[model samples]
Target chain A: MADRVRVKSWMPPGHIRTPAYLRGKTGEIERRLPAFPNPELLAYHLPAPDIPLLRVRFTMEEVWGADAERPEDVIEAEIFAHWLEPA
Target chain B: MPHDHAPHPYRPDQDGPLTEAQVTEIAIRELLIEKGITTASEVTAEVEAMDARSPAQGARVIARAWTDADFKARLLADGTAACEELGIEMGTLKLVALENTETTHNVIVCTLCSCYPRNLLGLPPDWYKSRAYRSRTVKEPRAVLREFGTRLPDKMAVRVHDSTADMRYLVIPSRPEGSDTLTEDALAALVTRDGMIGVTQL
Candidate 1:
């Protein structure tokens, strides 16, 4: 009997999480954040909830202006969790 | 086991004095702690700190945007950086800042949750995080701003930005002329937290 692997990913629809500006707009994966159960899940079971995870740093040009007019434009943002390519 | 529509023992009406809103919050917090999303102390502490910070800072940013073109340009280019240049400390990640300029007035809403620019303006206002504001701001911005006591000129355009991710937006309102004599502090005083959210004007 093989154990089941839940193909759960954090970035998905219906989450009160990150803004649209940060998603699907590929940038360097910068770092791998620690994983924790989702907030909605935790809120379903706990008295108080805290989100535990690592943060990724993204430069501004990578976010708003990979296509922006000014090349010198540099801004930064942090996204939670890293997407893992299928094995 | 098949069809139990009966209320749970923890249902809102069963609780005393607490509104459905209060009950929902209690239940949600319980679930989060039970599931290890966050600890109670951390949530409580952070909420307290956020309440203490957002408004005053939001006021300052709005005021500067209203008065300084160079500052406004820098803010539009890189909001977090612009704030830091003005001495606002921000977390390097989990935050997004957007600017609303002339020919466009930007208003932010977090439909999923209150994903706000806590660094620049502090936490979002209660209305901004409300369902009514969230739903209508995008679909009927003029109506929404009207509720906030703002009546946009017929020619001006309103662009609503959703803080659908961790990203947030700050409204850089047009500067009010004849304010040349106003000191920075006085100008900042005119900048309301609501002004930054684009619900009201400074």
Candidate 2:
């Protein structure tokens, strides 16, 4: 079964992989990606640790509400594990 | 495109004093060379290698997929490995091949920054790196596609990939109708960089 996830709405000031527009939006996991050094930490040359990444697929309706051009149209993005929470 | 006319439209850097960015670049280059980190010849060679890349490399892959079903399956399964199988150096670039079907159209964008399959398609276009294109592609893809003169039926679902992380995205555009009998090289010639980017169809 495809895992359902929601992007966390946090806006902490730092280098983040998640887009602002996708905050608080829920989507299905399209696929799980390999772990990589977190960009948020790597950006500052901090002690970077590997983090899991997932490609989450969100429908236009979920992302844009009534302003969506079509309900079925989709948007997929790679969200770090920290940015994703179980919906 | 330069014209050897009396009036030159472009004033190259030599026409004026070096800009701050250019000066900084020269300084860094000199320091790096002095420190034995890299040589000017290595930099020039790297630039030459980059210059050797173009959309033709990507077109070859697309054309191969069009003519060979097995290759297309492999490409969809693992884009980087599939490209490497064709002797294209993908380096550490992971790729996801989004196939554009009749019922759906696929487009790629990096809303965070300019993430692209540069190895296959060469450099990303100037418009692809602009904030307007980045923001609008996710918000209003249909409108942006219309601006590119690509109009799909309202019923067709548009899938936009916001490459916000490690993997770069490429749209494998469907082969045009009535081109089944064409040779692979001929079909490759028909493929355009815009088509691979999902901005236009061949």
Evaluated on chain B only, what is the TM-score of candidate 1? Answer: 0.70
Where is model 2 chain B poorest over a 10-residue stretch in terms of lDDT? B1-10
Candidate 1 chain B minimal-lDDT segment of 10 residues: B1-10
TM-score of each: 0.55, 0.94
| Predicted candidate 1 versus true structure: per-residue lDDT over B100-151, tens digit per residue | 5455565666656667777766645466678898655544566777776787
Off by over 4 Å in 1: A1-87, B1-48, B92-102
* DockQ of every candidate: 0.08, 0.90
DockQ, computed on Cα atoms, for candidate 2: 0.90
lDDT of 1 at B60: 77
In model 2, the clashing pairs are: none
Best candidate according to TM-score:
2
Positional deviation of residue B27's Cα in model 2 after best superposition, in angstroms:
0.9
**Per-residue lDDT tens digits of candidate 2, residues B1-202?**
1111245355477767899989999999999999999999999999998998888888999999999999999999999999999999898899899898889899999898899899988888778999999989998999998888899887788999998989988889989999989999999888888888887766
What RMSD, rounded to one decimal, does every model reach?
Answer: 12.9, 3.7
